[model samples]
Target: MNFGERLRFLRNELDYSLRKMADELDISFSALGKYERNEHQPDFETLKKIADYFDVSIDWLLGRTQEGYDHAIRIIDNAVEKMDPNSEVELYIPPAILNEMILKNIDESHLSLIPVYGAANGMLNLSESNIIQYEFKHNQDMPEESFFYIISPDDSMKGSNIVKDSKVLCRSLDIVDKKNLEEGKIYLVSYQNSLYIRRVFVNNQDQITLQAENVHFPPILIHNMSDINIIGQVQSVEFNPNEQK
Candidate 1:
C-alpha cells in the first residue's frame, strides 16, 4: 500500500475516524482528508508524526520498505517461542504492554483466553460468556482465576473514556472484598436485580451513593447496603480496537 493507503488502513485498523486521527496528529481534518485522497501531502514533521502515531516506520509509511508495524511483534514472538518457560531468569511482560500488542492486531491464537460475560442483574449470573483474550496468563496481582470480562453496555461511564462494548476487567468480589470497597472506585453492581456501572461513595455502613459520571444519569442512594450487591471491582477497561470512532 502507498502512504495514504497505509495511513487509512492503520486508522481503520483501530477504527479511528479521520477527525479523531487528525486530532491525534494535531492536524486539521481537511488536511487529513486531503492526504488520504492524495490531493495534498503532509510536511516532513507531520509525516513523521503520522508514522509515529500509527507505530509504523517512516520508510514503511513512505512505501520505501514493506516492513510493517508488526515487524517488531514478529521478532518478539519468535524470541518468546525459543525461550525456555522454566528458565531461572523469568521474563515477565506487563499486561498493558501485552494489550498494546493485542491492539496492534496480534493473532488471537497467541492470547490467553478468559471467560467474557455481559452484565445482567445484580447477580450477573448470565449463562453466556466471551471473555478477554489478553497475552499474559494473568494480570500480576490479579490472577487469571480471580477476574473475568464483561462488556460495558453503554455510555454511562463514557466520562471515564470507557465507551460501550469495551471489555471491562472485573475482579471477583467476595464478602470480605465487598466490605473493604474503596471510595470513589467504579464497580459492577447489582441492585433491584439489574446491573450498573457507577462510581461508589461510602455513606455509612448501611448506606452508600452510586454516582454516574454522566450528568444525565442521576445519582442513586441506596439506604440499605444489603440491597446493593457488589459483584466485582473494575480493574481495567479496554476499548475494542475495532470499535467505530
Candidate 2:
C-alpha cells in the first residue's frame, strides 16, 4: 500500500469513521475520502494533524516503513521532535536489481546507474526487502560505493538553498573518511533510527554536530559518534517542486 492506501487501512483497522475523522480534522467528508483515495495530499498542517490523530509517524503514513508503533514512536516522541521528516521517497527498485548489485557487488560496467532514495530511514544497509520497481537513471562515472540520491524532505536545508523535492546526490563514506570528516560540509546521516541531511562538524575530541542550513532548526550535537551513522557526503542537487515523479 502507498500513502493513501495506508491511510485508508489505518482508518478501517482503527474504526475511525470517515465522517468522525473529517469532522475532527475540520475538513469536508469528500476531502477526507479524496485523501484516502490518493487524489489529494494533505498540506503540512493537516498532515501533522493526521499523524497526531492516528499516533503514527509521517514515515509510516507515507509507507516508508513497515514498523509499528513501538519502533516508529522514536521519530515523533524523541528530542529534536518534529525536526526530521524521515524523508522516505519511495522508488521503483525491484528485488532483482538488489540481488544483482548486492550479491555480486556488480562491476563498474553497471556503475553508470545508481539508486536514489528518500531521506526516510537509516542507511546502514541499502537492501530494503519491500522496495519495488527496477527503474534506473544513467549517471556517468558515479561508481562510488553506496552512491545514492535523496529527495529533499523539507526546507531545513534552505540555508544551503536545498529545498523540498530537491534531488540530492551523495555517496557513503569509509571509516577513514568518517574520521577525517571535513568541517562545514553537508552530509546525509542516520541518527537513532531516522535519516538526516545536515551539515556536519567534528570536534578535536571526536564529538559530532549536525547543523541545519535553515536557522529554524537548531544545530544538533552528538557526544557519541556511535549514536549516528554518517551515510555520505551530499555532492549535488536538482530541484523541481512540480516534479511528476
Candidate 3:
C-alpha cells in the first residue's frame, strides 16, 4: 500500500477521527486529509511523529517493508551498528525514504534522468539503477536549457573533486563550437560514440585537448572539432549521499 493508504488504515485501526488525530498530531485537519489523499506528503519530522504515534517504523510508514515496525527497527539498528565510521561504501537507505526526503526539501520543479556512465572512448550506457532526480537551481544566472544528469564513471576526474559515482548536472550543448569553448572548464562530451566528463583545453593549432583531473590518465588530443560532440557543460556536482536522508 502507498503511504496515504497505510496512514488511513492505521487511523482506522486505531478508531480515531480525522479531527481527533489532527488535534493530537498538532496539525490541521485539512493537512491530515491532504496526507491521506496523497495530495501532499509529510516532512521528515511530521513523518517521525506519525510513525511514533502509530507505533510503526519509518520504513513501514513509507511502505518500503512489510515487516512489523519493531522488527524493522531492530534490523535497521543492527545494520547501522555494523557500519564503519570511515568506510567509503555508501550506507543503504530505501529509495522511498530518500525520494520523499528529496521531494520535501527541494523546489518542486526538477528533472529525473538516468545517469550515463563510461569512459571517453568506451561504449557509454545509462545506468539502470542509478537514476537521479535533480532540481536545477544552483546557478540562477545561467540561461535555461535542456539539462541532464550523469555519474562520473571512474576516478579520471578525481583530482578536480569530481569523484566516481558523483552526480553531475549538465546543460545540453548538442553542437560543438571550438570558438565558444572555454579552456580548463569541465564538460560532458561525446567522442567515438562514448560519453565523457573531462576538462577541455584549446590549443594554439585549434585542436581540442581533453584532460583528466588525475595525472595518471593521459590527455587526449583531437585535431578535428567535428570529432567531438559537446553534450553539455557540467553545472554542479552532488557528492553527498547523506543529503538524501
Candidate 4:
C-alpha cells in the first residue's frame, strides 16, 4: 500500500474516527479523508506532526519502509506547530524518510525551507521543525558545517553571552572526555541525563561545577565523573526577547 493507504490503515486500526483524528491533528476531517484516499499530500510540517503523533518516522508514513515504530528518545526533542487555530502541533515522523535519508544522504539543494515560529503570536506558543535547504556558489573557504539553530533554556552564563531564548550555534564536540572539557570555555554539558548550556567552572576537581551565566540560576555540581557527557560547545548566541513581544 502507498503511504496514504498505510496512514489510513493505522488510523482505522487504532479505532480513531476521522473527525477525532482530524481534531487531534488540527486538520479538517475532509483533509484527513483526502490523505487516506491519496487525493493530496501533507507538507513537511504537517507530515512531522502526524509522524510525532503516531510515534512513527516520516519514512514509514511515506511508504519508504515497513517497520514497526520503535520509540527511542534522542538527545534533543525537535518540535513543530500547526497553522490551524483549532488544533495543537504534534510531533510525528515516518521511519522510511529517516531510513532513506540515512542510506542516501538527503540532497540539501532541493529544499530551502526554514521553519520560523511566529514569536509575535501570544496565543500561539508553538515550535515547528523546519528543514531548510540551500545551495551556495563555490567559494574558496566553505564552512565545514552550517550553523544549526538551538534555543537556550537558561540565563546562567549571561556574563558569557548566554541568556534565555538565545538562539545559538553550537559546534558539535566530544564532551565526555576530560581532556575535551577545556577550562574557561562554554560547553553544552549533559550531566545525569539533563542537558545544560553552561561554562565548565571547575573541571580540575574530581567533581565538576557548571556555572550559569545568569546569577538567578544555581550552579550545577556533578559528583560522578562517569555521569557527565558533553554534547557540544557554544560557538555563538543571538538574543531577541523583542520577537516574543
C-alpha lDDT score of every prediction, in listed order: 0.67, 0.64, 0.67, 0.58
User: Model 4 has how many clashing residue pairs?
Assistant: 30
Clashing pairs for model 2 are 86-120, 87-120, 92-132, 92-133, 93-133, 94-133
TM-score for each predicted model, relative to the true structure: 0.48, 0.46, 0.47, 0.41
lDDT by residue (tens digit), candidate 2, 1-245:
78888778667755779997788778889999999999998888888888887676787777776565333233224322322345343334344443333222333244333455544442322444322211333344666346765777787888776787677777777533456777889887888776678998887877788989887879888888777877788887756564547
Any runs in candidate 4 off by more than 4 Å, and if so which?
A: 1-147, 242-245
**Candidate with better TM-score, 1 vs 3:** 1
State the lDDT of candidate 3 residue by residue for 1-245, as single tens digits. 89999888777765899999999899899999999999999999999999888666788788897555444354445444554445433434444433333322222223232233332333335443333332223333443346656667777888766776676767778656788887788888788976778899998998899988887788899999999988788877866332456
TM-score (C-alpha, index-matched) for candidate 3: 0.47
Error of 3 at 238 (Å): 0.3
* Count of clashing pairs, candidate 3: 0
* All-Cα superposition RMSD per candidate: 10.4, 18.8, 13.6, 17.2
Q: What is the lDDT of residue 9 in candidate 4?
A: 69
List, residue by residue over 1-245, the lDDT tens digit for candidate 1. 77788678778877889999888888999999988887887889988888778666677777787443464367356545644454332334455445455334454334443456654432344343322222243333545557777777776777776666777777777543346888889888888877788888877565688888887779898877678888888888765634658
In model 2, the Cα lDDT at residue 129 comes to 34
Task: In model 1, state the lDDT of residue 96.
Answer: 48
